[model samples]
Target: MSGHLDYEINKELGECYLFMGELDKAEQYYTKAASSNGVHADPYLGLAAIAIHRGELEGALNMYQKAHKVDPTDKTHAGIALVLMEQGRGADAFGHFVEALKVNPENMVALFSLVRLGHELNRLDEVVPHLSRYLEIDPGKSEVRYSLAGCLVCLERKDEARAELNRVLEGNPDFEPAKELLAQL
Candidate 1:
């Protein structure tokens, strides 16, 4: 088989092992994949996941950086942002999450994390636009809409919050959180 083909096979095996929670086997296949193609990013991303599973935050960050250097995909940016969040670097993570969203606006993980970090760090203004964008994409996601409502409440936009909460309640009448929030308004 060609080197690229070998890399693909090994990378697939690595992903399977990772999904099965066999970190050692996953690392071995990922290493083989990396050896097959020194420039491929997928193997490095797999390795980064293994490092994270092992609680080696620094190693995971390094591996994520290597993957980003090879190919700056939304997944790589999200991975880097997750590591940064684990390290309590919320501001840095926020930027990376934003970049990830820019690459793929429908990235749910980045969207949720950005909203969460924004709340934790009191950067609610930065979060509103993203939340609005997410709501535009997935209007039926009542939980997310409820979160947006909470953010609007924090910003003292009571009317907007009420509208969002109403939307959430309309979608899922049994959503107690939205109902409670609406009651507050």
Candidate 2:
């Protein structure tokens, strides 16, 4: 088989392990893939995700930066922003998240991170609008709906928030956060 095929297979296996919560196996395969190809970005991205899961934010940032340098994709930028946020650099993180969104406005990760950062900064107006845009992109995502409800509540839009919360509950009958908010309402 070709080296590129081996690299692709290894990268896929790495992603599978990462999604299955097996970071060690994921990292091993990603490293193998990256060393094999050194041309594709997926291996670097998989390694960065493993680093993030392992709480090695600096390593994750380095890997993600390399992925961005290799591919210049929105996913790479979003990954960097997420790790930066995990490292407690909220302001810097938000900037990269915005850049990722500007690169791909429908990036769910960037949108979700924006909502989180906006809320943390007490910028309810910004949060709600971002959530609204997220909804436009993926109206069926229950988590985004829940977040939108939270943003609405923060903005004192009680009725709209209640409606959104109800929508969340329609998908997940036992959604504790929505249940709690409904009780307060």
Candidate 3:
């Protein structure tokens, strides 16, 4: 069989096994795919996920880094950031998350992780523009707007926070948190 065909078959098998939670089988196929000279990062990404599931933080980080080096896609950046976060390196993860967001502003995982990290790092002010950008594309997301409101409140920008809460309440009148937050404002 051609190398490309072998890689595709192996990578597909790896994905299928990974989806079925057969980590050992998945790793075998992923390894085969990675060594087939296909120059693809899916195999390494699959390996990274397996390592993460097995509580192998260092291995996961290494695999994610390899995948990023192969192809620095938003997913690869997110993967690297997740491994860094798991290793208790929030400071290092922040930049990777930012890079992921830069590549795809609508990447929910990176956006939410960055928001959480911002709050943890006491950098709520820096998270506003990203939230705003997301909201611009999706206005009816009450949870996201609520999160933005919370950030604004922490930044002492009460007026803007109140406006955001009001918008959330407008979208879903039964949203108790928004109502409660607006009342507090």
TM-score of candidate 2 relative to the true fold: 0.73
Candidate 2 worst ten-residue window by lDDT: 123-132
lDDT of 3: 0.92
lDDT digits (tens) for residues 68-127 of candidate 2? 988988898899888889888888888788788778878888988898898887766865
List, residue by residue over 44-141, the lDDT tens digit for candidate 3: 99999999989999999999999999999889999999888887899899989889988988889998999999988887777889889988999999
What TM-score should be assigned to candidate 1?
Answer: 0.95
**Residue pair clashes in candidate 2:** none
Whole-model lDDT values for every prediction: 0.92, 0.85, 0.92
The residue pairs in collision within model 3 are none
List the lowest-lDDT window of 10 residues for candidate 1: 33-42
Best by TM-score: 3
Q: Write the per-residue lDDT of candidate 1 for residues 5-79, one digit (tens) a residue.
A: 888899999999999999999999999998885589999999999999999999999999999999999999999
TM-score of each: 0.95, 0.73, 0.96
Scanning candidate 3 in windows of ten residues, the lowest lDDT window is: 119-128
lDDT of residue 83 for candidate 3: 82
By lDDT: ranked, best first = 1, 3, 2
